[model samples]
Target: MTVLTKPWIWSCVAAAVAYALILGLTSGRGAGELAYAALSFGAFAAIVGLGQMLVITLGPGNVDLSVPATMTLAATLALKAMGTDPGTAMLGLVIALFVGFGVGIANYALIYFLRLPPIIATLAASLVYQSLAIWSNRGLRIKPPSGLADFATGRFLGLPNVAWVGLFLAIVVWVVLERSVWGRWLLATGQNMRAARLAGVPVELVRALTYISVAVFSALTGYLLASFSGGAALNMGAEYLLMSIAVVVVGGSSIAGGNSNVPGVWGAALFMFLVVSMLNSYGAGAGVRNVLTGTIIIGIVIAASTRRVRA
Candidate 1:
């Protein structure tokens, strides 16, 4: 079918297939439980993936490598700020968002003023961010406030609270990118920065804002994760660095830039988690899982690229 040709559709299909495979290995209500787990974990990936997709839409050679560091540092400071106070959820959230803002501005400043490539700037900044997190965390685990923890881990209408947050962000982002004037400017800028500038688009401002937005998104994920997991570990966001970019690419967002799809990101996020679960059920080792996952990603990229070429 024509619709099946959509790149994003594949992730959804894969997720379904993975779910079936897992179900085949078990009986009873395991299916529902597995699905719930997938949604709960996938939400984090989807949230960060949406942010990465925005920055990536800005064009090639543009990506935020500091997501994990941003997450770690923000969560560290936020948890520390709340200090397990009973009603300090908002305080912690604001602290986390503030940290994200600073990191975003710092990343852009490095790129704009120092003329550094995004990869280099974000990577360099990540080292500093990570150091800060280490110093602030001091190899200790700080618990999230009780209410915030419950809200993070709680469920709503048979779906995870975190999943609801992810869905909400996805909706907002989809609306902004698909319907707003600023979205048009972002797309135009991504398509051709020089042309966009000549046409009166504020390219510089767009870049700054995009960078900032990605960091803020990452920070939010970090805060929720710290709460959900009970504490923010120094390496809490390490795996998400790859997961963020992976979901973007797998969800049909163009790696080259100027194109994105939000539904695909969520689908891809679910698929990612399901695939790991399937592998685990089949007794695959971590190394084997990594190899297989990498292979799958490479194959998908090649297939997508060939299709684009044919089109």
Candidate 2:
């Protein structure tokens, strides 16, 4: 019971249960294979989810709707630049991060200067970013550099290399949020913007940095995903917009903000992958899978919210 109250725990439990059911149906076959697949695919969700978690932690109304577009644009540009080169992974990465930074700055400018709501600002910016992506490559699928592709698709120490990167990032984020002054300021800002400003928390700066961080995360994911998938596609990142938010929310981050769960985000990422696989094993179609996934996400979010209010 004590453990259950920890917001991150439930996601892990759900994942375990889903895996168990899937194995039961197959009479315990493919256990390792399923686990590997979940980690491999879930890494992207976890990376973006961590970024989204930070934005949401700044409170309600703060989110990046431009993630998919950012990913698409960054990947498109990075892949185009790298273009079958052998040692240009670093170049592609630099392009990706730069694109992310620019997008983040653009997002912040819209919110701060235009005084627009974050949702409206980001949603509007997404169109521009998407157009930029479409314009940059004109729907061409550019393959990543061979070395970059190998690193993205390769494994290490018995786990997917991408999963290792995700885990490392999760650790870094957890440390920053748990141990840094910036983390304190962010929490204060999220709890009450006016009060935090009164307390000299640099609320605006916090907001700016948070938005930038999320954009960078989205871009990095875009770069890696493009590499992993063999090329950059116009729609490679389309699925992750909702996925990033869902993982954050279902991981027990407070929807109203001021609270975050790094571990929960990763757990929720794994759960997302496992649940989909389980649904497929049970013969659920794509629509049914989506409906069930949405239902589960809503249920968990509601449960976490109610618990938070009660506590």
Candidate 3:
């Protein structure tokens, strides 16, 4: 049976329901606000998950560690460029996209020419990016332009604007992965870069595009997070490193690549964000909370590998 017809998806759904039940039972203090928080975080997870799907599923043997740094940089730049001009926010967003693409190119160049491992290359790039972020502001916090704040803080259909952005991204990625030749090449390259190269698939180009695409998405996510929080901080992206990886891994994508679990991965992202949200709601402290979240992510990684081996 296909993974879609298997128990994993249902398991994710069950986990989500169980999470809701737990939240339901503990309702008393600001439950509504807590619920909104859960939903908002879940949306953010979805956006991060999309980036992961594109990266890992597009290049089976490769994975990126620069997601957090790229995101932080893009967001900070976007907020900085906005600079109190509401009308220029669009231009700022465009710049953020180019920034993301630039990061991707840097990674691709290192991996392709220097033959650096994806993880190592991304790690080095992340350090450099983080350093630049610090150097740019001298460790100062950067706020979104005043006029641009309303979009992040505003609600449509009683949901945060970020949710809308996530929904749009999901739709866009789904279409690209399911319908386009570029998407097909991504999957093909991930499944077997050697075979793809022999088939004249432009394997290097595809891989570079995948990294670039992921970087772009991560940048957007960071921008949203910063806007939501009212400012971008130097350390903001650090915490997201683990959370983003967890979302993708739990969503059913393998670290080794080959198989792509699009829907499952999306569900897993939501499942994880809900887990963190609930844990926080229950007054779990940061240390305990991260431990629990990390444990769950490790469990998922093992389970996913076991499933693949059994298959």
**Candidate 1, residues 1-311: lDDT per residue as tens digits?**
47756777767777888889888888534877888899999999999999999999999999999999999999999999999999999999999999999999999999999999999999999999999999986948899999999999999999999999999999999999999988888888888899999999999999999999999999999999999999999999999999999999988888888888888899989989999998999899999999988887777666655665565
Give the number of the best model, judged by TM-score: 2
Worst 10 residues of 3 by lDDT: 3-12
Cα lDDT of model 3 by residue, 1-311, tens digit: 67544324642763576467556767555656755665677777778778877788865457778988987888777777776566877877887788888998998889989999888999999999888777776655667776567787777888778777887887887778779988788788888889988988988888888888878888887887887788777777786777677666777766666556666655676677677667776788999998987787667666666666676
Runs with alpha carbons beyond 4 Å of true place in candidate 3: 1-11, 27-32, 59-61, 283-288, 298-311
How many clashes show up per model? 0, 0, 1
lDDT of 1 at 294: 81
Alpha-carbon lDDT, every model:
0.91, 0.92, 0.75
Error of 2 at 1 (Å): 8.9
- For each candidate, what TM-score against the reference? 0.96, 0.97, 0.88
Runs of candidate 2 exceeding 4 Å displacement: 309-311
User: Which sections of candidate 1 miss by over 4 Å?
Assistant: 303-311
